[model samples]
Target chain A: MARVVFTANLHRHIDCPLQTAPGRSVRAVLEHVFAAQPRLRSYILDDQDRVRKHVAIYVNGERITDRERLSDWIDDDDELFVFQALSGG
Target chain B: MSDRLLVGTKKGLFELRRNHADWSIAASHFLGDPISMLLADPRDGTLYAAEALGHFGVKLQRSRDDGKSWQEIPAPAFPKSDTDGLSVSYLFCLETAGADRPGWLWCGTIPGALFLSKDHGESWTLNQALWDLPERKDWMGGGFDDAGVASICVDPRNSTQVTIGVSTGGVWRSGDDGASWHAASEGMHAEYYPPPRNHAPEVQDIHRLVQCPAAPDSLWVQHHNGVFRSTDGARSWQEVTTIRPAKFGFAAAVHPHDPDTAWFVPGVKDECRLPVDARLAVARTRDGARSFEVLTKGLPQQHAYDLVYRHALSVDATGTRLAMGSTTGHLWITEDGGDAWSLEAGHMPPISCVRFG
Candidate 1:
């Protein structure tokens, strides 16, 4: 299982506990996690389900490029990171 | 007079209580979060606060038992079919339907959309009529990069007769409780545009629109270039050309009972938002703009760079008490109708809106 880590700042507002989720794609992993932890979707995505402009995601220590589709490829043992964009917070 | 005040600021929500002549900061909530708008719903004493979290998104919470406890409510958002790629950028205004209609609320937002909730803000839906208006295509932002619905006035005589002010979009009125709408700023003009386009009712930049509660037909507007008054229930407007200390301002408040009486914080418009001659002043009209008075009783007269936002100047229901907050984080309360004033807080986050309950 791959682990997903959220910024400490986000924890200040809502709790997104550290956990491992299943998936080989960023979107699928997020969907798997969002199903268990609700209201977290709104903070990471917008009305159109696109990654929020101020939120950045990473897979295996590399920043995801497809923010809208969140189609970044991932490996089974890779880690996912969610963070507020540098210029945002 | 109001004994309680709710001041939403750039970083938190500050609650002040008044005991006789003294005011104290009783509590603070959502600290370190930008509070964009607030409504201490006079109809039910239910308080709603709009938190604008840029990194995440806009969030909403309501407190029924004062500030003791609050429940997070869903913030208004654009539907997936937003062809223009529109999303709620900010929650600009929140207003009740009327005293007769309980649990009904109206919310205005940036990118210029109006929302409504019939269940005490438990949920909200975009007002389709105003959102889909063809004239909205002409609307653009003022100082903000995107236009917004900044003011909403539900007629006291009839809640169905709703009037709203868009930052770069002109005044709109709905005769059927948000089911339908039309441009109501007929005589209102915009100096930002040229010749014929300046007269277009759709692009007038109304800084704020306020209705006198006792005289529902009388409306006052603080515009981008000057001030305007409407006596025919917002169907038509007439410019007030006599205001001094520079006619440009963002905030306007009217006396609850006297339609002829109103207050404004005048300053230089556009990029230069400083007080004229660096002297903070409140311009008041007691005779329907026939004449004006610049009141600076306790406000800074030297090196005063305070600029009051549209929702920052609030007049309580009694018409005698007024609370004014500025971009410089200065909050002042006037007990004698602008004849005198006193600073309550000199250091705090820049205030976005101030409301009395």
Candidate 2:
């Protein structure tokens, strides 16, 4: 099981409590999370399933590079943080 | 129907309710969020709000109980594609299809895209026919990087027939429910562009488009070049250069049941986008733009530098109530059409759009 946490700013709009889901890869883990909270997909990704320009995701405190594939492997105790990148004036 | 006004602003959404001759703020939601578009469905009385967040992107919220509570829903997004570099900047317009299509909703957005939802805005799909047009390659945004669909007018007589106005992209009409599209800006001119390009069919900059419900065939447009009206279903337009002060404006409100009556707030040319002579007034034409009467009752007439956006002026279904908001954070209402106006609210965030619910 991987632990997933959302930014406080996103919590202001939707109730995205800490989620724990079982998966081998980041993509599979996020797929399970998004299935429960579908509205978060539009804010995090664009039409092509690519990570949105201002959205950032990190696996074990390191930024994920494969935004399109999102195939990075994850361990049972690893943590994922999804946050909106600081943007605009 | 109870009188209410939904005001979208750069900061949040403000709801105003009428009490006798004056209007007061009823509720305010989405504080500190940039509200771009708002609409109230006549069929179910559902209120939809579009917000653009700098970090999170575009979002849609819906309320069924007159905005007392809201729920965020999945918004329209471009399909992931390698070559597509488009992202929704903001939603420009929200409209219901008609009485026949109960749960249908139309959304026009920045980057010049049209989306339709059959399940009341829970999900949306892009109109690929309009997006795939060859002319779209040249559609540039007037204010931003890409053109935006500023207005959408669906024919009440035929829900399949739709007219869309795009900034810097001209007008497009679809007679088969957006299956196909064609340029309908024949006589509309774009004086800002050089010769030949100025008269091109798809180069006109349309600020707003409004159609009279009583006569669906009659359409009024506030073009960046001037003000125009088309009697043959937007197939052609004739500039109404006779409008007093100047025809350069962003907003136009049409009477609900009168085809010949409409109102506009005229500002100076693009160089100076303020009211003529620094006097804020609503210019109305009852005889189809033949002449104009400036209504200034209870409005600022001296040193006022307010500009109304394309969706900031609205007329209710009965054509008796009117509400308008300004970029300077001033709101005004008229219970008896455009005959008289009174300040409803002031000193708030800059208003983006206004709708009477």
Candidate 3:
């Protein structure tokens, strides 16, 4: 079981989800996140399930650009952050 | 049944609310022909409307205590002193700073006019810096006279730092309580339209402006050409999402408290098609404008042409009420944002515009 933190710009409080999984990687963690929050799946992934453009996912302070292998190996105490990339003026 | 829909149409202003399990016209008048935009105040529950036609010109009408009573608060026309000021043809948009200030209304008009009202729906003062700014001389015309002042965004936390988008002219910012102004269109597109330069550069016409309250520097702008995102206020923008086949439409609304969540309706560009294949749908970006998904649950099936104008989209206090009115005299509401929409009211004149209370 791994502890995951979920945060968005709109809310004042943070949400944390706990998932128990055997596979270890960013992809596995995301699959778990999406399975738990279906509405969040579309927001985080494109039609092909690739991380959509303008989205940035980070694990333990380091940004992860690869969406296909989002399930990259993770240790027990790693922190993950998923957020939208802003661009309009 | 308590919630009502107010619509501005080519004929006049009309209000539709439920009475005895049936939707009925609460009020309809041709006070100012071709009523363009409608804004309902949540503070006092008054409906404020903008006229797009006739010599009556950009008048602000309000209804106190719901739609039971109505009064017109002679909003100001362009002062004669500024010979270069835009002529009052239409009022495109009106926004309340917040629920904190009872009567403060900011109105956007045709010919690129911005008016501020400190006294509820009563008198209005013009933001001169916007018209007198050094950038106006460079603005030619985008051909669509109604395109002016389509974007009016008030900072959630700070009302003083207001932003307005002027088509072809670029986005303008009023930081010091509208006393002075500066061009915030640095990263915005400005498609120059002239006999020789007809098609302005891409990303020029910004139809919508929204800010992340948590990240005020982050703004989202929907253009006639494309969508852009800026993390540093209006300093710079980068193209994030461009879904071909549908590029035009007005009004992009951000969740009242959640800056990361926003939505916009898209229609075919230039060719003048209804919003997104003539379907009643909304495209939402839960993570800001970085990406978007078409929200079609509970929408019409036959693909009706329901064009929702610039002033028609709004998100309520809890961000639970996502209400939008269409030019086709239809009003839709979703308690769960744009994921699914239910027809709150329907069947009236071609609705010129709609707003929320």
Candidate 4:
């Protein structure tokens, strides 16, 4: 089983809550997280279920770019961190 | 009753409706000037619009009974001497003072002007107090244009406590119904000022202001650089959110009931037109300003360059419905508290501004 954590630097605040779930692949892991917190899903994915261009996610410190490839194999001890990638002038 | 959507295009005002199963454009004979704002008042089902004509300047128009007919309001003229022979920009916001204070319409303008309409959309009077503020001199030295006044909120219960966003001028509060005002930009992010340090410029260029009706002093301001919350009227404010996106977009709508619930759209850089490759979406903050969530469901993925200016976002009186119009000519409506959204219009013209009816 893989574990996932969610954090954001929202509204000038930081280090809030870290969402955790148990699953074998990224898709299964995200589905579990969405089932528990639906509101966060919209911020994480686009209308086509792809990771928003502004959002970034890392699986066990390794950045994951494909939204559909969430079903990739993962270790039970692996962790995930998702956040908005800040960019601008 | 038919649901009508009045949209402004590069060509004039376009009235539209989703008939049966088809979304058809009703009329497009307004002459093609870009529309700056569109408002549908719910109290009486009236529609108002602001259009920006090249060289001719900004103009205001209205339609009583939903978008079936239209007429222009005489543009408030400034003495040729004071205006430098230039006309003021079109109205950006039209807010009624509610049923108890009928016929009280307040409009915010570009370049930071505030006008009051006591007779629906008829005659207009500029709030000299806001127009001639001592800080006006320091607030006008920002980016491109002075931005403008984009947000205005009137306390439904105590019309005395009114708040307005002066583009890059931060936020200003008036406890006596626009009679006099005070700067509420303390601690806000004002980037256009002298130096782009911490939060100085923010107190100057506020893009949106949403005052909590229950707690009149508690307000939320969306600035060009960050978001702020003031719990003690205008005395102080706390930094809530900051966006360093590929670009910048204006507009902030607060939930009618939950002061903690609000929404804003952050586009690419302030100098750019596209939304980081045309992927525009709205961000949500549920716990007042503690955190934010981006809502992309039902929104376009590719070529999504909709720019939602201030006042383009609105929530029904119930606060249960959330709606925002985009510059890409689309309106996204959410009835289930923004957990999900439905596309109301796909292509209208880049929507300049939107108000709920």
Candidate 5:
């Protein structure tokens, strides 16, 4: 299971706490996270189900490369961090 | 009369209360957020405010006990398809479907799509019939980067008879709810285009479309170029060339009881979007569009550069109480029609919409 964490700024709009989920890719990890907190989906992705331009997801301190498909590979012991791009807010 | 006013602004949603002599700010909600549209539902006094956040996209909030508290509701979204993927950039308008259909709501959104919420904003469905029309392919952006639903006029006589105005696209009418629809008319002319192409309905840019509740057949529009009046239910529109000051404006409010009486905020055209002579005045006509009377009493007459948006001017059910908000962050109200408008608030933020309840 990979550890997932969201920025503290998003806590006011939707609750997102540190958690561990089993996934091998960024897309699967987000799907596991959104499956529990449904309302958080739109805030992270747009209508096309792609990552919002202003939001960034990092895998163990490395920025995810693919925003459209979010196919960046993840390891079981890796850490995922979601942050709202400063330029957007 | 509705003494409560809801103003959507660039920063937040401001609620104001009317006093014996003037209006004053009572409460503020969604501070530091851009409120795009508001609806004070007269059916059951339900208040709705739409916030367009730059970072997190659009959000909808509803308050039943005035402005005391709000509940987050799901905003309308476009369905995903491989052929064409569209998203709602912003909510342009929120309108009620007459008093009879108390729970029904009509929403106009950017990308020129319409959505219907039967459960009072709790859930919304995109109007697919409207998007499927062939005329939509010709739709273009007016002032926005893409085409948007500028105004929605639901027929008072029948809730199903809806007439929608798109910013760059022409007007569309639906008779049997959302089952079928058609281009309202080929009557309006587009000065931006050349020759016969200017007369095409798809090229028309309608700024705002408003209909008189008492006389549902009478419709008035503040077009991109000028003013137009339609007495035959938008089947045909006759250009009104007699408006004083200037015919270019973005907002128009019709009296609830009188079809002939209407109010419009006029300013200079095209290149210059400021008020004429840098003075703010509302043009009122009691006998249709034959003539207009500039109402400047209690309003700034010099060094004022306020421009009202499409949904910023609203007339309450009494027809005497009217509220107007401007792009320059000013709010005004009139209790005796449009004769004298008293300044309520200023220096707040740019206003997008106003609703009285």
Candidate 6:
């Protein structure tokens, strides 16, 4: 099982509370979480099922590289953090 | 039904209730969200708000209890495009099919796409017939990169017959419930485009469109070139060349019960999208487009630089009340048709649209 947490800013619009789901990869973990909060998937991923340009996902202090596939492996004790990248002046 | 106004703005959604002789803000929902469009279904009193988040993309929220509470639903999005760099910039229009077709809704989005939802706002599917049209390849955006569907008119007499106005793609009609479409910009002109190209079928830029309920076949359009009216369900358009103040504006409000009666807020032109001499007024036409009367009582007569968007001007079903919101965050309403007006709200976020229900 892996723990997933959404940023406070994202939580303002959606209730993406701490979620624990069983999965071996980031994509599977996200799929499990999205099943519970379906609306959150749109805010994180675009129509092409790819991570949004401004959205960032990290697994245990390391950022995921596969934005399209989201195939990064994770362990049962891993923690995933999803937050929007801050930009603009 | 109680009189209420749903105002979508750059920051949030504001609800205004008619209080006897005056209007008051009842409540504000979706605080700090850019509401691109809003629709209040008279069939079920359901309220739909389209929010365009800068960081997260588009979102749709629905309220069944007259906007007291809202539930986020699936937002309309384009199918994964492997060739075209397509993305929904924002939802530009939200419309119901008709009284005969309950729970049926139509949504127009940027990048030029149409979506239909048979279950109200719960789900939506892209209308591929309009998407796969050959003219879509030539449809370019007016201000942005890609064109957008800004207005939709569903024929009350026949739900299957519908018309849509694209920003730079001209008007299209679907007689088989969006299964197929054909360009309906026969007599519309595009003075902004170069010669020959200006006469092209799919090159006319439309700012807004209004259909007369009294005559379903009659439709009025505020084109980028001029004001036009179609007597045969948008099959052909005739320019209303008599409209004062250059006939260049985005908003058009038609009378609910009279096909000949309509209103417009004319600006200078494309280069100067403001009232002539900075004087604000609402032009009303009682005899179709034969003539127009400029109404300025209680409106700014000098130094008023306001630009009304396409959906910002609306007339209620009763054909008596008219409301408009400007890009400068000023709202005005006319309870007695267009004879007089009063400022209802000011200093708020830039208004995206105003709907009276």
For model 1, the stretches where C-alpha displacement exceeds 4 angstroms are B82-84
> Can you write out model 3's per-residue Cα lDDT over B1-357, one digit (the tens) per residue?
135656677767776665554456677765336777777776776677665433212455677756566665665566644233334556777888765788898887767778888888567777777767765655544546444777677776778888777765667777777888776665544333444333332226766777766667778777666677777777777765543336566767776667678778877665674865566678887775656788889888566787777667777656766777777777777778887887866765566566544
Docking quality tier of candidate 3?
incorrect
Candidate 2 lDDT tens digits, B1-357: 448889999999999988776689989999989999999898998999999887778899999998989988878777767785577877889999888999899999988999999998987999999999999888888877789999999999999999999997999999999999999998988989888788776788989999999898899999997999998999899999778777889999898789989999899988889999999989899998888998888789898999999999999989878888999999988877778888889887899999987
Off by over 4 Å in 5: none
* Top candidate when judged by TM-score against the true structure: 1
TM-score of 6: 0.93
Model 5 residue B214 CA deviation (Å) reads 0.3
True contacts kept of 5: 0.53
Two-chain DockQ for model 5: 0.67
Q: Going through the candidates in order, what is the number of backbone clashes in each?
A: 0, 5, 23, 25, 0, 0
Q: What is the Å distance of residue B55 in model 6 from its true position?
A: 1.4
By DockQ, who's the top model here?
A: 1
DockQ, all models: 0.74, 0.53, 0.01, 0.01, 0.67, 0.55
How would the candidate models be sorted by lDDT, starting from the highest?
1, 6, 2, 5, 4, 3
| Per-residue lDDT of model 5, residues A1-59, tens digit only | 99999988777677888999988899998899999988888888877888887788999
- Comparing 5 and 6 on DockQ, the stronger one: 5
Model 5 accuracy (lDDT, Cα): 0.88
Tens digits of per-residue lDDT, candidate 6, B1-357, equal 238998999889999998888898899998888999999898998999999887788999999988888988888887886764466778999999888989999999998999999998788899999989998888888866789999999988888989999999999999999999999999987988888888787898888988997898889999887899999888889999888866999999888789999999999988989989999988889998899999998889999999898899989988888889998999999888889999999887889899986
My TM-score estimates for the predictions, one after another, are: 0.97, 0.93, 0.68, 0.69, 0.96, 0.93
User: Which pairs clash (backbone N, Cα, C closer than 3 Å) in model 1?
Assistant: none
Clashing pairs in 5: none
Answer with 4 or 6, whichever has the higher DockQ.
Answer: 6
Model 1 chain B lowest lDDT segment of ten: B80-89
Q: In candidate 5 chain B, what residue range of length 10 has the lowest lDDT sum?
A: B80-89
DockQ of 2: 0.53
